[model samples]
Target: MKQSTDKIAVLIISAIKGGGAERSVLTLGQGFHELGYKVHILRFKSLTEYDLNPNLAYHLLKFKPYKLIPNERFRHKLFARAIDNFIEKKIGKPDIILSNLEPSDRVMVHSKLPNIMYIIRNNISNKFRLTDNNKLENKISKLQNIYRKHPCVCVSKGVENDLQARLGPHITSTTIYNPFDKQLIKQMSNELYSTPHSVLKPNQYIVHVGSFTYQKAHDVLLKAYAQSSKAYPLVLLGKGKMFDETKALAKSLGIDDKVIFLGFNKNPYPYMKHSRGLVLSSRFEGFVRVIPEALTLDTPVISTDCPSGPSEMLPASSLVPVDDIDALAIKMKELMAEPQSFRVSLDESFLPKNIAQQYIDYLTS
Candidate 1:
């Protein structure tokens, strides 16, 4: 499939939440825009946590009446219909549609739009395991059937393999790693903060940036940090439902004084740049964006060898067994002892422009 001059691409996701999936969608939109395509982001709501590209257009599916309906199934059906109508009337038909997240994917699949590409940004099986609701399970089962009928993009080889194992090989899918804008990260990291965070002392603290959640396994990180002999404070960035619980865990581990909970900072790049090292303790991830982002800043990283991403992004020596407090503690100690020795350049394959081209090829193909 050759590129068309008048191509129009529409990227759909539930909302602009501060997560890897949202960031990936934003990066892809920018990529498509750079390729001379008219990019439009179709979101279900107007709520956003991350910044959007100025070049890309934005469309919203305004269906507030769906909330009035008491029945869940019928509400979803109406929501899907509303999306289809909005796309037809407001945006018309796009040359290509890229859908992210389950809610948006469900609507896209239900719309039965042509040239629809569903992006699997996480380990679906692990996500499903995170919940036990029968209704949600049924919804996911339906989404899986819809996913089978469309071309899909997985963020990593491990994610691609996991999807195939669950949905079978009949599904057409391709692996495209997430893009990292190294120059942009460096530029942002250099921006001076009006008020410097007191916790960010020079080479005195390691950083961990992610939502405070069970999947991130902050407990494991806290336990590991507690066991380690390093004196550097652990600075945690990002907020979530488990923020208080994680704080309590740190206190219980007797490392509260050494751990600084900064909540969420819009610009964590500066912190990443100044930190001695970054740590990711996810139990499973589709792809850990922080790994490459940290490496881009010339910061050493120690991560758990989770199901899909850490091993793929970091050297084997820098990865420890998942959820093994002792192993993570040992790795943390080694990293803190010689953080400079562990620093390595990220592979050029993850360059933003290169990965962006891969997306264009996949979408066009």
Candidate 2:
């Protein structure tokens, strides 16, 4: 499976929508492009919002999945053909194909494409525990079938272990921690942020950067914030279905005025830079990027010791128990009182070029 430097690598994803997974795809595209691969992002849906790279290419090929077909295999095969045909016409045959998210995996596993692999960005087993408790084994059997078709690359070791612990040794996959351009993140964090309302002052507010989703456990954060010392305002950055609901929760907690909801800024690094510290209270996570992102800006950070990610990079002092409001509140008070930031001691293997090479090597080997 070895290839020349000028090879084509098509990244299949749901959309270029914002989130950690989407950001990872775009950043990896740059990594592939930099390595002299003709990198292209082929999204089934056209929900674009993130900053695009000039060196990379993107194609939106929307096709209706044949769900009405009686046979599951036949319909998925038909869908995969549409994806293959889209690549055949839009670009030359790709040297390798990497699919991300559940949307792509739903059909791309049936794809007869070349050297295809799936990138797992979530705690799949934990998600099953939350969503499919009644028929967990059957759901895992379905996933086992998917892995049999194309191997996977998990974003964290905990994610890999969780899958293997359930799916067993028969699965084909490896862990590759998410890559970050630290200097770029630091540079962007230096940019001054202007707001329409009262401005955000440096070291005067506590910040949390995550979409208002159940997975983010915003309710826990709100409860904990209300119990904290309230030395600084709590700034919530990001927007989703849970936005209004989270706002309502803040009001219910009687901390509405003390909580700031700044919905979905393209760049949240400045807020991370200026905040006293960052907090992530996710119920589960793949790789908590903000934990490291805040560390990159030298901002003190704390997170729930969720299923994955946090403990991998964060020291014990920076972690609180998942879904524990009291524990989080105590730590929140600690952060407000102290200005200490952790040293960014991430692995050099997490660099873009190194990570890109690892992907290539994984496919070739």
Candidate 3:
């Protein structure tokens, strides 16, 4: 489809109010506005705290149609229907509707509008997993038949492969890694770096910034941190059901004293900047966005070589085998002993200005 020349209105939808996917949408909205396009955000619920460029305009839809579904079995079907109505009514047929999360994404693509292009940006790895239960074939068909035949941009190559393998190469998806604002990253880094080490307190602390969820493998992270003989603090930043379970696990490991659950803090950069190194123990990722942010902040990183992201994000020498407590611990140890050399080779592709250009191309072309 040829790129439309108009005001270029874009409507984005997401499930939750925060996290990497939410932040990515907000950053892109700001970038879109900077490119002189009109942008609007339609969220299912409400945001606790979020940052968006003040100039950008948005609309919020607050409804629990997903909750009204008789049960979880056909909940996705009902949720998609609800979003369809919202797009038809409030959205008023934008140039494009961008769905960034599950259920909502399925709905937007299923609308089958010819004038309005539906762009579904895959936010999780499980959505594209090839399996009978996943219903990938049916979903792909629905997308192609319904939406105005726009591209499906998976955030990571692993996600792209899973889609291609299950749905076949004919569906061809693009892998667009998330972009970061290099200037903002450098600004944040400089601001954090200038703070006195005495005030920031260079305590023996390792930071993990992500929701307390299964994909994050926080259980394994806490366990690995517990096994560390080196006496250092392990700080977790995020709120979820797993928070309590993780606390109990720490207590059971007899290392609860070493773990500090900071809950969710708006500004984690200061803590991340002053920490020994950032640790990520995810089962899989499109690309772990936080790892790059940590590197930008000059924080050394110790991550599990999880499917798709870590091996690509970090050098072969920097990654530990996924779910291997011993390997994770060893890398953590190595980083703590010699941090500067490890961070010198950080990747620059994620910088915001570079990423903004990619979005501009997507929107314009």
Candidate 4:
């Protein structure tokens, strides 16, 4: 058997964007670097928002499939080969390879790359939106084809179970929650930061930090916020395609003035640190990264009991049913009426070093 430090880990993703999964993937790369392995992040795009550690190797490919190739499977094979050639020439073969997100998963499905594991970041059933049952089944079949090849690592047990139910029992999978830089999160929580929009006042606002996506269910959040006792101003701290539409919905709900959109801030910790509480009203999530971030700051959080994460992270008291506006509104009011003495501790296993060990154990097993 090889020593742990002798193993090389390569993580492939689209890019280092401002999404939750990307954030945790970067932290996981850092964890591998800290464990004394030579780590590399091979990405298909050059986009980056977060500061990267200098110790880890990063290869920016900015890849696009050649549409000239008629067959999708054959095209993916060539794409995978291009990546494999670069890895062999520049960095040698990775001892273990892990793929993230859909684009990367596409090539990795046909990849002859060694010891590869596909990381399922969300609930498989909710992976797409389709009205036709046949279309949905076709999409599910595509995913089954990709994930069927390798041993999988899901971000939550809920995701693992979803995969089993959706894709059947042929594949092997396990749950490994994303790693958080707990110390960094705690330190950043104390930071004095500024946003282009209105300045955030400490202990005076309820914060909801997620992109304006269908999965995030911001409409539900806004509707529920309007019905709540209006105890605190709401701060939304991310941007998406539905941002303008969501803002319009806020006005339609007559709570536009009470809701603040600061777009996407790289450091949302300062806001989380001083907020009254953090709220997540999602339809589904791989796992809400902010729940751990808020808990690291000792701030309370309320989330919809969505698939793949909230239940694993928060207690029953802090959860509400998904898409239930009335229940969420009542919970919000209860949160405000009760004393703000909620103290919760996130598990130490969330720390990057420990989470990295879980990955190592899984890959080496």
* Top candidate by lDDT: 4
In candidate 2, stretches whose alpha carbon ends up further than 4 angstroms from where it belongs are: 1-5, 65-72, 130-134, 341-344
Which of the two candidates, 1 or 2, achieves a greater lDDT against the reference?
2
lDDT ranking of the models? 4, 2, 1, 3
Q: Write the per-residue lDDT of candidate 4 for residues 249-302, one digit (tens) a residue.
A: 999999988899988988999998888888899998887898988888888888
Better of 2 and 4 by TM-score: 4
Writing each residue's lDDT as its tens digit, candidate 1 over 1-365 gives 22445677888888888887887788777777767777889888788887677988898775566779898567767787777676666666677788897777666666756778888888878856856686666756665687887888999889899988777777899999988777778999997753245766768789899999888999999999999985688999999999999999998988898888887776789989988999888898999899889999999998999889888877888888889999999888887888986787898777655776787787677
Which scores greater on TM-score, model 1 or model 4?
A: 4
Best by TM-score: 4
Off by over 4 Å in 3: 1-6, 65-93, 112-149, 185-200, 344-349, 360-365
Per-prediction TM-score, please? 0.92, 0.94, 0.81, 0.94
Question: Any idea how many clashes model 1 has?
Answer: 0
**Where in model 1 is the C-alpha error above 4 Å?**
1-5, 70-74, 130-140, 194-199
The alpha-carbon deviation from the true structure for residue 346 of candidate 4, after best TM-score superposition, in angstroms, is 0.6
Q: Which TM-score value belongs to model 3? A: 0.81
lDDT of each: 0.82, 0.84, 0.65, 0.85
Cα lDDT tens digits, model 3, 164-247, are: 664555664576677666566556554543332232356467789988888788888877776665556777788876889988
lDDT of 2 by residue, 101-191 (tens): 8778878987877889899898777657666567887788888888767788999899999878877788898998887777778888888
Q: Between the candidate structures 2 and 3, which one is better when assessed by TM-score? A: 2
